[model samples]
Every structure is written in structure tokens, then in C-alpha cells.
Target: MTELRDVDFFRDPNSVVSPYSYMDDLVQNSPVWIEPNYGVAMVAGYDEALTVMRETETYSAAPMIAGPTPDYGVEFTGDDIDEQLDAVRHRLPFNDQIVAMDPPQHTMRRALIMGLITPKRLKENEDFIWQLTDRQLDVVLPRGGCELVDDYAQPYALLVVADLLGVPEEDHPMLLEKAGVAANGSLTDTTKEPPKKHGGLEHFYEYFTDRVESRRREPKDDVLGRMAHATFPDGTLPEPLEAARIASNLFAAGQETTVRLLATALQIVGDDQGLQQKLRQDRGLIPKFIEEVLRWQGPIKGNMRVARKTTTLGGVHLKAGTQVFVMHGAAGRDPRQFDDPQGFDIERPNVRRHIAFGHGIHTCPGAPLARSEVRVTLERLLDRTSAIRISEAHHGPPDARRYDYLPSYMFRGLTKLHLEFDMEA
Candidate 1:
């Protein structure tokens, strides 16, 4: 039997925990090695990934990933996507979402979203966030030990976004479940049919639609209601349909990504007593530590893009219809990009340069929201638990320490994050 090579780890990302193992070789040997299994070129080096992002002129982000678009009874299929897959693509609402779009149009959509999670709004959520954190911890902390992902990360992510998006508390669990199935599909094959299908998004559309209508009836002081009544500089309010589409996108994308981060951060800090102590001692460093962990171990694995025209990258020529897979997770460990790339130094310089949030016009707009969720969760979790560690080996396999990564080629995150902690202090 052949051994697992650096390139092979990416072949089944879910099975392989360390995506960075091949970083040194990729940086030195072949930064832009094409993978035959996935039928796309993989970009590993930091410079190359940035080049793909910065030179949008040569490398387009419009077709970031290959899949079907959500039809939703709308006539938005053929212009940007292939015609044959219209039926399949019609089910995914991401087509109208910001992450799937590019400049000009992308700019307009982002402006509307940015308007909602503004500086003042983020500041407003801080107290509410901590209060919510306390409420959640109060329930779990007493247990002394819990599966962080199921007990904490999942709920934390759901409520944080629900509070900001103004999702009524009662409706949160149902919405989170529906959205979770859809998101899990990007990781594994189990999500082929989300329970709601178009229903999940339709539910969102209705929810936001009602909010917009209510805001029209009587404006409220929340972002959703405000967005319900927001207008462009040209006096054209985003169509009600578009507004719902944007809201739906934010809820789904933001929620899953945040859940992954919270789970991964705790897993990393939980295993290392020293790291946990440092964060617990100085709660102020939690935010910076979150940033480092994002670079060190982000939830999203890669970004996909389609070639606009014949172009050359890393000395290889790409045709217009070619698919390029930019491995952001692998890029973070590129030696050329960071000295001692594999080292998880929380205080590393230029760590902000990581491609975790992506780059260029399509950069993730919900990044600030994700950062806030992680920071507050860690601050409170550390405050409650004096020490955290992976559970005893006698209770499980020693190799279980490896993060059971997600199976999807697009997003990479932990499937199960189990930890044992002592709160006796």
C-alpha cells in the first residue's frame, strides 16, 4: 500500500486532518499543482493565491464554485451559469447571494449588507452578546464537561446571528437545523436534500419579507427592519426579493462559518493548557487570538473560481472554461508567505495577511461578525473553565485527537470537537 503524500491529503480533506503537511513541498516543488481527481488546478502558495484574488482582471471570481444556482422561480440561470445544470442549481439560494457575485453588482449587494452590521451596530451587540453568552454558559457550565461543538459552538453561532438578524428566539432551533443540513452538504454527501429544500430559503424570504412589510407598516430600530426600509443613493431600495435573498445568505453563510471557528478555537486552546492560561489571564487578547486561530485553523478550506479568458498562472496556461481551486488553508502555511509557516504562533507578525476571509471584491462581509462571536465566546468560556484538555485516552482512541475534518472540497471544519475541562477551581 502506498503512503499518504501531501497532495493526497487534499484528495479526501475530510479524512486528512492536517492540510498543511504538504505546505513546504508545495511551496518549493509545485505551488500550482493541478489535481486530476477534482478536475481543477489547486493554488497553494500565498503569493499565487493573492495573485488570483488581486488580479481579478486575469482571474475572475464570478464563478467561485461550480454547482447549480437557485431558480426560486426567478429567471437568473443562464447568464452566469451553465444551462444544463439549471434544474440542480435552481435549488441553491447562493446564486443571488454576495459570495457568488462579482464587482459592480457585487458592490451594490455588499453595500446593503455592510449597512446593517455597521460599527455602531457591532458596538450595540457587545452587551447583548455577552449577556447571551452568559445565558448559554449558565446552562452548559454546570455540566462540568460537554461536547463543545454540540453544546456550545452550535448554539452560540445560531443565537449570535439570530440576535443580530432579529430571528425570534422560538424559531431559531428549526431555522438552525434547516440551515445546518444545507451547510453540512458542502462537507458531506448526507446533505443531498435539505429537509426544506427551497423551503429553508423560502422561509427566510418570508421572514425577511414580513420584516420589510412590518418596517413599512411601522419602522423598528433593528438592522433587519432598517434594511427593510433602506434605499440606495439613487433612491432605489433593493427590491423586496433581493433584500430577502441577502438576508437569507447572511444567516446561512455567517452561521456555519462562525460555528466552525468557535469549535476549532476551543479545540486548539482546550488541548494546550498554556495557551488557555494566556487567554484566560488577559481577556483582551482573545480577539487577537481569534485572528491568529483563523489563520492557524479556519473553517473554510478553499475558494473556487472560473477562468474568464486564457491566462497564465504559476507558468501554466489556463483556458476560459477552466476551474481554479485556490487552497486558502494550504496557502496560510506557505513558507514563502510566512516564516516557519507551520508554527501556530498566535503573536506572529503579518498574520492579518492570511486569506481566511478571502480577498478582493468578494471578501467576506460577515468577517467582523464572526470575529465578535469567537472573541466573546472564548472570553466567557475561559472565565468559567480553569483548564481544558482532550478527554483521557482510555475513554477513546489516541488518534481521536486529530480534528475529524469535513468531507467537502469547498469548506473544511471540525465534525466533532470533544474536550474535558476542570472547573473545580
Candidate 2:
């Protein structure tokens, strides 16, 4: 009752683990081919994906997290549906949020976040990251084996983002419970009763609103304080709710994505002892490995953009309102972009060029923090562990391994990663 050819990425459970062959076939056919099953134009080519990202005026980002299938509640037509889309945008889910906004609104709101993650701030955060990695490892290393996602990845990533945002130390456990398991867990599991399109971020919204209002009355020398005080380029202060939404997006969304990257990095090393030893010997390759991990198993699988106008992408014509799903996983491995795309080469020279964080203005601002999280975690993990191994009892033998991926259309993350390790005396 299921078919691999003309497969639907969202519906097909089989495609979760082995999507590359299907992705390869798509790229071979055309960069932006509309799926026969679903009319969505799947952008699989590296250059083609970049074209859609760069041409911001021609696409409506409302579909990015709006839904798997977007309906503006109004028809889109003509060579330019910019005005049409704008008129009905509010009707679309979360139209006020950053990822859903267009031009002027997006530009202003995005600057507020970008301003907070300065080089100085990131450097300070690195110290916390190094120490936190050890603290997390301290708990798991003693057990010798642990479900890496629940024990380490989720908590570590949540706290790192909390520290970055200056979230109150006392509130961490509550935030973790709300975000770490319940919110993040439900969000990645699509089978939940209510749709899980960023419900976790709601918990952050209420928390940040109260905090941002407090920061406004009595300013503190901290990241959230700066964010609370940050004004639009026009010098107008953001509404408390508006500021809170942005912070929630940064806090909750940013944390979950990084967790996925961390899980994948650990899985890679756990699966390959040789690679683990290679990394332990040369810590410098950790950066390259992180990039390669991001390229190969990008945290975000697809970013959808609704066509604002009738346009041609790689010679394929798209009608207005068509949701062009940009496949980061596919595009990163496109043969035209990288020499030996499928093969995981940590030393791949042009590796950084992959749009794992995206290519243009809409690129993820938290990318540096994510890269740091992986690098710091890997360094500490390798240093603290005599050896890292995929738990044969849980994942089966390497040759005939079994793993469960999070059942979500938008994200790429392990549902659970079980690992056994040797403690470094």
C-alpha cells in the first residue's frame, strides 16, 4: 500500500531513514520538480534552492512553518501576488511571527535577534558550553550507557539556549520540563491530537512576556534585557508580546534544532570507532565534522516558500501559491555542488558552502551558537569518554542496525539514541 517512487516525504515512514536515493532521483530529474502526488514543487538542486532563497520578493515565506500545505484563505494570481498574499497573511497561521513575515516586518523583527548574538556574547557563551558539557557528561558517563537524547542532548541544548537568552537560573527546571520533553517531544511527534506546529514555543511566549515586561521596568545588563530594550530600526519599541514571541522563537526553536545536530554528531561517532579515535587525536577536525554533519543530516529538512508570482525555477514554471519546498538535505548532497556528495568527507574543502543555515537574508542567526554547541560537546565528550559505542542491545549490530527517527515532516532527528560509553579515569 506504500510506494517509494513518487514518494511523499511527509507520509512515507520508510523514507525517513533512506531518503537520499529518492532525493538523488529528484535532483537528477530537475531542480524544482512538482511532486505528482502533491502539487508542491520540491527544490532538490543546490543552485535551484539558492535561487528561491535569494529571490525573496518572488516568494512568500508564510509557508515556512505555516503548514505542510498552506492556504492563504484567498486565491493568488497574476505575475505578482505580493499584495494579495499580504492582505490574507494574517489569516495564515502565525503570520505575525518572524519566519512568517515578509520584507519590512521581517527585516525589522530579525534585526532585534541578530543584534543580541554578538561575537562577545557568543565567546562568553562558549565558556558555559564547555563547562555544561562536562556537567552533563558527569551524569551520563557514570551510568556507562544512557538514552543520549533524553539524558544529555535535550537538557544540554535547552540550558545552552537558556544561558544565551539570560533565562533566570531558578526557572531552568520548569522550562526544561515544559520545553525539553513535553513541548519538544510532542512537536516532533506528528501523531499528537492537536497539531504540533510549534506549540512548545507557546510556553516560552508567556514566560518571556512576563520577563520582558520586568526587564523594561528595571533594566538589567543581560541578553534578554537588551532584547527587551531593542527597538525597530525606526526607533519604535516592540510591544511586549511581540518581543516575547521573538525570544520564544529563539529560545525554544533554536534549542530543539541544535539538539538534533548534537544527536546526529554523537550517533556518527558512536557508530564509527575509527572516526571517534580520529577526532580524539585531532580536535581541529571537530569543526569540519560539525559542518559535514550539518550538510549531510541537516536539522531542518525542508523550508517552504509559496510562489508569489508565476515564475520559472530551473526551467520549471511555478504558478502563484505553489509551495516550493526547498530540500536542504537534498540540496546539500547535490553532486553539482560537492565533488563526492554522498560520501561523508570531513575534509571536504567547500563544505561550508552548504546552505544548512540557508544562503540569503533569511539565514538562521543562531548558526554560530549551533556550531559551537557541537564543537564543545564533541571535545568534552571525547575527552571524558575512553570510548563511545552504539549500544548493541538497543540499536542492534552496526551492519544490521535499527533506529527510529522523529516522526515529523520538517525536522531530521533521532527519536532516541542509545549509547554505551567507557569512563575516562
Candidate 3:
């Protein structure tokens, strides 16, 4: 048996290059097993992951980051855990984000966020998605082939979220750069020492503070205006920092995952011409195809949770404060949950049940927007191209396709996707 220390699941760059095969081995040993490397409990089974997510009281979302909170030079010495946590958060760079909050606070913050992306707003956003898709395709289609990630996916997702948030068109590039850094900085890379504070977070705080204050003074007719004007359930507006936190969180969180999803979806279809044609022939199947792609190759690999109290999961005893990793990618491949789970089947009836967007309260609030982006992307790509194929020069032969995924354990996406497409006459 390979020792846990020998298996650096989250840290080792080479190990993360092809994580699913590694995850398969880990899941086979046990659905919920203690990773000896970090001593964090890893839950890989679909049911087990859901168990952890649904039982929020037993498992807190407070410690969503993989490793110890950076020292931040603040030594918290206190018997009161809440007080200690509060002190710790005050010192951390991005403490006020919703993902790191607990029940009452999380509930309220999520509600405010939900209000900002309301159904009417989403409907309006949906109507504009086609226009956005065409804008990207107009640039890409003129060229014979392009790298999908940089040329299309990243920009499309970033712009969509930017539009949704009412980020001015002029500031999209800068905001995307900052949010990209913040998103990438959040992932733990075991090879390096953790920084006391992420620079991106500080940048976001400053950027969003100005945006929030400006919106407060003169509310525009857009999503930021809604967010700026939004009140807590108690009828009080969020403080400047709190409003900044909400806006920055939305900016950072919404874009990257969706980019990953788009890249993965395009990669799958680009590789399998038959599957690509099937969806192109019948556009109605695009939604189901997207769902299956999410189940089979979702963007998020896993997320972190902490045991709020000593509890038993999958027959393994866990102590309070123990960090738990809910392996969503692994869970999607659990045989108990999906038959022949590795196979991609668009016709699969229960494919939507996969926790690609996660489960429970922390479920991605931007799931609707993400789905719309992907659907529109495919609709446009297929309409514009007669066929799409992986660039053999870049990815090698079909039998031995070469692709590079993001180095981080938390994200699953091709760093680059080179494609050759035939334009529609």
C-alpha cells in the first residue's frame, strides 16, 4: 500500500496533473478516509459528500480553505471559539466573503446575494447571453482556430458575470485580472509557504470599497445598484466593508468556475466529433449534454468543510475542528450514485442531481447564469462551425491526446484548448 505521505493529493503538481485517476484510487480504498498527508478527512462518495453538506450543523463551512488559516501575525489566545474565530477573521485578508460564514450570517449574506441576482435580472441576463456569445464568436470565428480558454471561455465567463454585476465595460479587464488573482490565490499549493495575507484580497477590498461607496451615493439602474441598495432582512444596509465583501465575492466566485465548466465542455465536444455532431444536430439536447458534461467533468474538484463537533461519518470518527474535504468530482463518479459513472451519457435521467455546483446552502448561487453561458456558448459555436476538432499539432494524436489541467487540486480545467473548426458556409 502506498503511504499517505507518499501521496500528496493536493500539493504535488505532477500528482494533480491527472487527479481523477488518483481520486479513483483514493475513493476505492474508502469513501471517507483520513488522508495521512494532511490528516484531513476526505469524503469521496456521493452519499457521503451529500451527508456532510446537508448536515451543516455537524460540518461548518467556516474552514473552506484547505490548510491552516495563514498566521497573519495574530495569535488568538482565548477559550471562546467564536471570539477566537472573529479575531482570526479580522486579521485575514478576505474574511467577510459569504463562503466562510456560518448559519445566521451566511443565511443573511446569501439572501442579499440572491436578491442581487433575482429572477427578473436573470431573465434579462439570459436574453443578453446570445449577444455576448456572438461578440466572442465574432472574434474567434474569423481566425481558423484558437485557444479556447484564453480566447473564448475565460473572457465570456468574466464578461457575463461583469455584465450581471453591472461592472462598467471599461473596468471589466481590470476587475477580471484582480478577481482571477484572488480566485487562484485561494487554492492551497503545498509546495510553498502560505502567505500571511493574499494580495488579491487587499486589491479587491480597495477596488470594491470605491465601487460600493460610489453606488451608494448614486444608485444606477443595474445589478450593482440593486446590491448597493439591498438591505439585510432586518431592513438595514450592509456596511461599506460588507458591501465591498459581497461585490468582490460575487466578482471572484462567479467567473472562474464557469470558465472551467466552459473549457471542459468545449474540450469534451471538441475531442468527440460524434458527440459534438449529435448535440449540433439536435440543439434541444444541448442542455442535457451540458448537464452530463458537468457530471463527468465539472469545474470544481472538491470543497473543504470542518467538523463542528465530534461526529462519525462513513464509520470513521472525526473530532471537532477536523477539516473535511468533500470530493465532488469523485462523488460524481461513485457507482452507487450513477450507473457506469465514468461513461458520459446525455440521456441519463438523473444527471442533474450531481453536485457539480455543490449541494445544500452553499450551492453556487450563480448556477443559473453558468448554465446559460454554457448553453449559449454551445448554441453559438455549433451554429458557427460545421465541425470542431482538437488541434493534433498541440494535443498530439487522438490515441495519445495531450492536455494540461490547472495545477490546483480544487479546480479542474484545461489550461489551454487548441481547436480546429470548419466554418459554416
Compared with the true structure, all predictions reach lDDT values of 0.69, 0.82, 0.78
**What ordering of candidates by lDDT runs from best to worst?**
2, 3, 1
- The TM-score leader among the candidates is 2
Best by lDDT: 2
Question: Can you list the residue pairs that collide in candidate 1?
Answer: 64-304, 68-89, 69-89, 69-90, 70-90, 71-90
Ranked by TM-score, the better of candidates 1 and 2 is 2
- RMSD in angstroms, candidate 2? 2.9
Which prediction has more favorable TM-score, 2 or 3? Answer: 2
- Count backbone overlaps in model 1: 6
**lDDT (10s digit) by residue, model 1, range 1-425:** 12323344445543346655554566556788665554466788788888888876556555555422213343322223333333343344355667766565677777877777778877876767898888877876776666666667766665677677767677766665654532211222335764754335777787777778778788777676788887755568887878888877777677668878888888778767788888878887787788778887788778677655567888977665466778788787777777877778878878988889888776787788888888887777777787777765422554554456677656667777777667737
Residues forming the 10-long window of minimal summed lDDT in candidate 3:
181-190
Q: Write the per-residue lDDT of candidate 2 for residues 256-369, one digit (tens) a residue.
A: 689888889999999988999999999999999999998988888877889988989998999887888989888998999898888999999999999888878778878888
Which stretches of candidate 2 lie above 4 Å from their native place? 1-5, 180-198
Better of 1 and 3 by lDDT: 3
- Candidate no. 2 TM-score: 0.94
Task: State the local distance difference test value for candidate 3.
Answer: 0.78
Ranking by TM-score: 2, 3, 1
